[model samples]
Target: MHTLAQLRAGQLAGIQRLQLSCGLTEFPPEIFDLADTLEILDLSDNALSTLPDDLPRLTRLRVIFCSANRFTVLPAVLGACPGLTMVGFKSNQIREVPAASLPPQLRWLILTDNRVEELPAAIGACTQLQKLMLAGNRLRALPPQLASCTRLELLRIAANQLEELPDWLLGMPRLSWLAYAGNPFSAADEQAADAATSIAGIPWERLQIGQKLGEGASGVIHQAVLQQTGGQQDVAIKLFKGAVTSDGLPRCEMTAFVNSGDHPNLIPVLGEVLGHPDGVHGCVMPLIDPGFGNLAGPPSLESCTRDTYPADKRFSVDELFGIACGIVSAARHLHQRGIMHGDLYGHNILHCGRGRSLLGDFGAASLFAPDGPHAAALQRLEVRAFGLLLEELMERCDLPAATQASLTALQAQCVSADVGARPSLEEAERLINSLRA
Candidate 1:
């Protein structure tokens, strides 16, 4: 949150990062002075319209964020930054993304809430590409060349105009997390289960909301009590802000949650909020048992596709088995109902110290038929995501040589390049149980 006054005074000299949101309408000349040391820059929430042509002078720059600006085109100068790897321009009016704007070293890219109807074929040249976010765009399809990004792990193409999922996308060897809920093809199918049927309407007046429990891109969760249900009982309530998130619509997420059904490792929806003066949407569920927290933090810019854990984090083989089995069970339940948990990262998982875990967050959930033609391919893509989680857990544990070998083999099977060759989550759960025995 650097101020223009501080930057001009040269007080931020030798800084590795800089952020200025003082209603900028042009690139600050003072920024060029930090070319030798600045590695990250954020100029979001401003009226900036363009970047200087010689923006490459920032030799050490590795990341840039210019979200919520007035740029109609991506600056070509970004491509000249040799070390740049992450870029974001979310919630802008940019309609054109020149081929020269994409850098070869790019990893995570965000272009959410834009009017982009197409992407350049040069996207295939970035073999190092990993996470890509293009939600809330006008894209009708993706360039087939994207399949060349075998290292890609997370993807979000929801809230677009796509008529069908790309065949190559279904075959991407590393694509794990996906969200395509708002597309015409899948949006129709997502309504298969009338949310009104699976979710009961509970009035807000019957509950007493308490302090915050947690918050995410779409809503805030809080501890609440149902006063009218015979006796007061503790529950968790999620009140949606009703915004278009990078994932998709809030109602779509609510639909997926309610229809996900009962599972040992799922935080099932017990009731849905109906009446509120402001018309805020919300849901009620059983309060989580004490002593549970997120398994990991969301991905960082440097580690674009993987979750990060604390330095002292460690899990024994038994605890790892329990965590793996719980996740596998929950996934099987979702897939059985033709639902895809698009955001399957460790950050979306909750775990107790003893290996018990639960999976939540439906913002990225998408719907398809269990017997649909694309079901197998979609499920296999999620298998790759699960494999990554297993890999992370395995790397943190000390186990016998035999046990380690077995776990590694199963993970390999899950993330196999050939989609059809990958084992189902059910099969993975079965093999994990054998390891436990």
Candidate 2:
């Protein structure tokens, strides 16, 4: 939130990051003063529509975010930047993405909530690309050239106009997390209606909201008390903030949560939220145990697609096995019901010190037909994610020689470069159970 006055006075020199959002309509020439040091620039929430042709003057820039702005086209000058690799232009008026606009060394790109109908095949030139966010767009198809990006790991194409997912996407060697709900091919609404019939709906009047528990990009979780005929019960209520989130629609998330079904390692949804005065969507679930905390933190800028763990975090062989078994079982349950927990990172998991784990956060989950064409491939894609999780946990665990050898073998199988060769969740669970035995 640096001010133009401070920047003009050279008060922001020698800084690696610069953010200015005081309704900027023009590129400030004073920014060149910090070109030697600025590596990240955030010009979000402004009135800007374009970038200067000399944006390459910032030779050190690596990341630039211009979300919530007025840009209708992704700046072509971005490709000329020598070191820029990360770009975010979310919530803009962007309708066109020039092939020349993509940075040569791009590793991450976000074009969410825009009017983009197609992507340049040039995106395939970015072989180092690992993550992409294109939700809330008008894309009707994905470039087949994207299959050449072997390093890609996470993808969000929710709320787009795709008639169907590309076959190449399911067979990608490195893809793990994926969300494709709210598209023309999505059956989310129908699945949600079926799931809703099996669950009770709790009226808003019966809920007594309390202190806020936490918040995420999609919704707020709060501690609340629900009045029922039997008595009053403590619960956690999640009220969605809006129709669209970075992942997809709130109702889609709500559908995933309610439909996740019963599992020891899953957060149980008690009921659907009924009758919010503002017409906001939400759901109710059992309050999580106070002793539980996140297993790990979300990825830092440097880590990109992996979760970060506490510096001193260490797990015993038993604890590691417990977490692995629980996650595999939860995943098996999800895949069995044709659900894909698109965001299955350690950060989305809650763990008690005793090894009990609970997987939450349905904001990125998607529902698919179990017997559908891509169902098998989709399950295996998630298995690669599980493999990565196992590898991370193994790094922190104190394992016996024999146990380490076994887990490492299983991890390798889970993350095999050949997607079709990866074990299904059921098989992964079996292997995990064998390890515990």
Give the distance in Å from residue 200's predicted Cα in candidate 1 to where it truly belongs: 1.6
Candidate 1 C-alpha lDDT tens digits along 215-319? 876688999998764688899998886656778778788888988888989998889987977988888989998799999998877788789999898998778
Q: Which stretches of candidate 1 lie above 4 Å from their native place?
A: 276-278
Residue pairs with backbone atoms closer than 3 Å in model 2 (clashes): none
Question: Which candidate's lDDT is highest?
Answer: 2
Q: How many backbone clashes does candidate 2 have?
A: 0
Global lDDT of each candidate? 0.88, 0.90
lDDT of 2 by residue, 345-383 (tens): 998889997789999998888888898888999999999
Find the 10 residues in a row with the least total lDDT in model 2: 188-197
Please give the distance, in angstroms, between residue 90's alpha carbon in candidate 2 and its true position after superposition. Answer: 0.9
What TM-score does each of the candidates earn? 0.96, 0.96
